[model samples]
Target chain A: MESLAAVDARLHRELQSRYEALVPVLRHGTQLGGKRLRPALLLLSGAAMHADRTAKNPLTTEESATTEDHVVMATVVEMVHTATLIHDDVLDKATTRRHVPTINARWNDDTSILLGDYLFAQSFYLAATLPSTLACRLVGQAAQKVCEGELRQVLGRDWLDIDEETYLDIIRGKTAELTRVSCQIGADLSGGDEGQVEAFARFGNDLGIAFQIADDFLDLWGDDDNVGKTLGTDLQQGKITLPLIRLLRHDDNAVAMAALDALRLPPEDRLGRVMPLLRKSDAAEYTRKVAESYRRSAIEAISGFAPSSALESLKTIADFAVDRRF
Target chain B: MESLAAVDARLHRELQSRYEALVPVLRHGTQLGGKRLRPALLLLSGAAMHADRTAKNPLTTEESATTEDHVVMATVVEMVHTATLIHDDVLDKATTRRHVPTINARWNDDTSILLGDYLFAQSFYLAATLPSTLACRLVGQAAQKVCEGELRQVLGRDWLDIDEETYLDIIRGKTAELTRVSCQIGADLSGGDEGQVEAFARFGNDLGIAFQIADDFLDLWGDDDNVGKTLGTDLQQGKITLPLIRLLRHDDNAVAMAALDALRLPPEDRLGRVMPLLRKSDAAEYTRKVAESYRRSAIEAISGFAPSSALESLKTIADFAVDRRF
Candidate 1:
């Protein structure tokens, strides 16, 4: 958490520019903080490997210098996340996020759209300033995947028959790929071995997928008071998440019809009525199982890496993804 | 023109990807096919230097190898342009571009926004793959400027008091910066001298400003049939351009009031009434003179480069920016 605060400071320092109108929005996006999970994963990955160096080779100078690169990357990954959030808010027509006014709600859509683009360009610009093109390439690849995935989800709206494979593809692109890259960048930069880097990559991929599934679960069933934002948004927006998909795959057409009719109701009332039906089926339990399985894989991924406290932290983080209430 | 066509072919190949829903929109945006001026400028900048190499240094293999880089950059720059066009369509709510339906019109705004972001990521991805970070840095910087400029324009939408200085800043960011980078990339990759590269950059900056001014002129006064898209769109959307700004500086309050009122009318009738007032004030002529001044400077910027047929071509391109009817 202190490291995340440091990342926040770094973001403020990096994004504060003379573009008078642009800087405030950049600051707002960065400061409208979420869990800082990605930054933490990245930092912890590098820190884990750095801890490994102490027990193994203990080369201080080059390893110490790479720590700064990791910090820069932590800042960049957060900015990338913030940019996507701004754009997603616009697409979802969300009025608030993290109990704060959404960029689209505070400003108009044009400004929101352009500001998202500005943040992305700023992130890439910062990425270019790094010593290697690896970060830039990875970030670009993730950005492409995220956009493509978002488009797929947009096009898939109102289609109730979205299969499990389609859901996996969308979640992998929209959420998991960036998380995987964040971890890979951290490990790869910290002089991680091939196995160590690959391990972190796998850990991040599974953790990210699990994270999105849990997040979707929260949207439907999480505490509205503690979540600090509107719930039942996916249902309101007609987004087909895994739980809904699982519920649809069941053979009972009558229950499916009732669920569909409930989804068409207002957001405030739909989740209340839909939850009972969702619970009557095994959909929620099944979704939780899938998420737990991925979380287990994520924790298992780092088992062969040199043991460190940061590795334990990674396992704890993955568990948090499955176990958190919000 | 053949070179521009090559860039077109290259864009088709580069943008063709496995993301089935995204590829068609990407193709549509790239295939909309404007003047391809940015790509032409890029290719000519590289070719001009290559032609100079034959006369001066006579290095063959490595120099010829970079021609392909030029082609790749040509495609990247065009994709960047197309990306901006896609976002601009969403911002402007335009239905058609270059006589075809815009991506925003064919799909929804969300798709257009995501596709614009996808193209930008793809462009940067391509930039990163090149042999140097110079292109990536230039592109990131230009992209940032373009977004900032667009945001400034959005914030200044209905503000009638936009000064010439603010206007210059906006256009420099939104239009000139990318063109400058395109040419600078071409010359830099072709191994041009510092003077030559800077000259190409300056040439592009000036030519781009001139091009935008000419385009604004066309929007206000060019024949609608020839322009092949909607005319007087800037006025219709309440966007203030140079000609209108110049006309507003006049002491004739009654005329200014009449012109402003006419601009609020339907697109069909606004130009009919506003043009007389604009012509009487010589604002159109003033805008053209201003454009011609930049055009002259653009030609002057590259005059120091070694004489070649491509240099002549660059000169002709400068002339065409001023002299073209469409």
Candidate 2:
């Protein structure tokens, strides 16, 4: 938690710009209260790796002093996530996020776009401060995947024949890739071996997928107050997430046709018409089962590591990814 | 010219995406042929530095073999430029660029935003491939400034009292900063000493300012057929460029007020209303004189370097920055 606090402080510092006009907008964009799940995954990954290594061989004083680097990497990942959220808000046209007005809502699309871009550049600037180019390279690759995923989703809008595989691919890039890279950076920076780093990456990837699946479920069926943001945007925007994809693939031809018809309605009425159908089907249950499976895999990915609070935290996060109502 | 060709090939290679859907969009975004001015600045800076050094001491084979690195850096700067243009088109709502439809016009705003982001990430990814983090840091810093500048311009929309100093600051961040870093990366990567690198940066900064000023003039006065993109969007978008800023500062209050009233007209009429008033004043000549001064300074920035074709090219570019109609 203290390390997370450090990450928050570093994030604030990173958002500071010589162009004073951007600072408030950056702060508003970043300070929207999310779970900070990526940063937590990163810090917990680093701590778990450090603990596993320490149990076998004591770390040098220099090795032990990498908390600052961990914080920096954590800040970098958080910035990437925040930047995506800003741009995503512009695309989604959703006004509120985490019960607060988004950058696009408060300012405009141009502001949101430029703010996202500024955060991205600043993240690389922070990563480049590290001794190696590894963080910059990994973050770059991950961010590229994030954009690709989002682009796929945008392009796939109104795609009636969209399948589960395509949905998974979309979430993998837009959501999971950053989390995977967060864990990768954390574990590798803490001196984890290739196998351990790979394990952490899998853990992050599974967790991210599970998180997105759970989010898809929430968008369809969760409470607005609990979710703290607009719901049903996925269906409204013609995004065929896991629940809807499952609903579409239902064995009942009439039910599938009904779902398709509901989606074809105007954005305003589509969510209302589709919700009742989704509630009647096993789509929600199916989505939950898929997310839980990923959660289990995420836990199993790190099960081989030495038992420690950090390792337990990783396991808890995997559970939280699916179990959280929001 | 061969190096520029190499830079183009490298750029094409860099725009390739694993996501099949993104490849066409990325290509379309990057291939909207501009002057390739930033790449030229970078390559010329590298060549000029190399020539200056080689004149004193015959370079080793390894030293002479950095052409690939120069091309990569050149590609990096050009990608950054193209990314900004993509996002700018969205903000400006420009339908066409380089006599072709902009990504925003062909696709949508969401596509433009994501594609710009993807290009930015890919630029960093390419920059990370180099041996040092210098390119990454400089590019990051420049990009941050660019976003800041654009943000300032967006927030300053229709700001009637915006001063020339404020206009300069905005352009410095939005336009000049990236060019400055392109030359810095080129000179630095080519082993230019601190002083030489700083000199090249100054050269780029001045050239960039002059280039932006000329662009402003063209938006106001040049033929649309010659400029090759939608012109007058600045006034339409309430963007207060140098010419209008000068017009606003005319000795006669009535003329300044008329310019202000012209700006306040409907977006469709603002450009037409402001054009004649601008022509009647000394604003156009004032803008040209200011741009020409910066062009002179850009040429003067590199006068100390050994005279070579590359050096001459840099001077020629400085002249072109102010002289070209487009």
- TM-score (all chains, Cα) for each model: 0.95, 0.96
| Ten-residue region with minimum lDDT total, candidate 1 chain B | B57-66
Ten consecutive residues with minimal summed lDDT in candidate 2 chain A? A57-66
Clashes of each: 0, 0
- Writing each residue's lDDT as its tens digit, candidate 1 over A1-326 gives 56777787888897776767676677777766588888899999887877776667765624452366888888888888888888898898988988889888887899888988888887888888877788888999899899988888887645576888889889999999889999999998888878888989999999999999999999888888877767888887778888988887667998888888877777667778888889889888898999999999998888876688788999999999988873
Candidate achieving the largest TM-score: 2
Interface RMSD of 1: 1.2
lDDT of 2 by residue, A1-326 (tens): 78899988888877776666666787897787488888998999999998888877764523662488999999999998999999989998989988889999999998999989989999998899988899999999999999988888777645878788888888899899999999999999899999999999999999999999999889877888998867888877778788888888879999999998988999889988888888779998899999999999999899888888999999988888899883
Q: Give me the runs in candidate 2 sitting further than 4 Å from their true place.
A: A59-62, B59-62
Which residue pairs does candidate 1 place in steric collision?
none
Q: Which candidate has the top score in DockQ?
A: 2
Report lDDT (Cα) of residue B131, candidate 1.
64
True contacts kept of each: 0.63, 0.75
DockQ of 1: 0.70
**What CAPRI class is candidate 2?**
medium
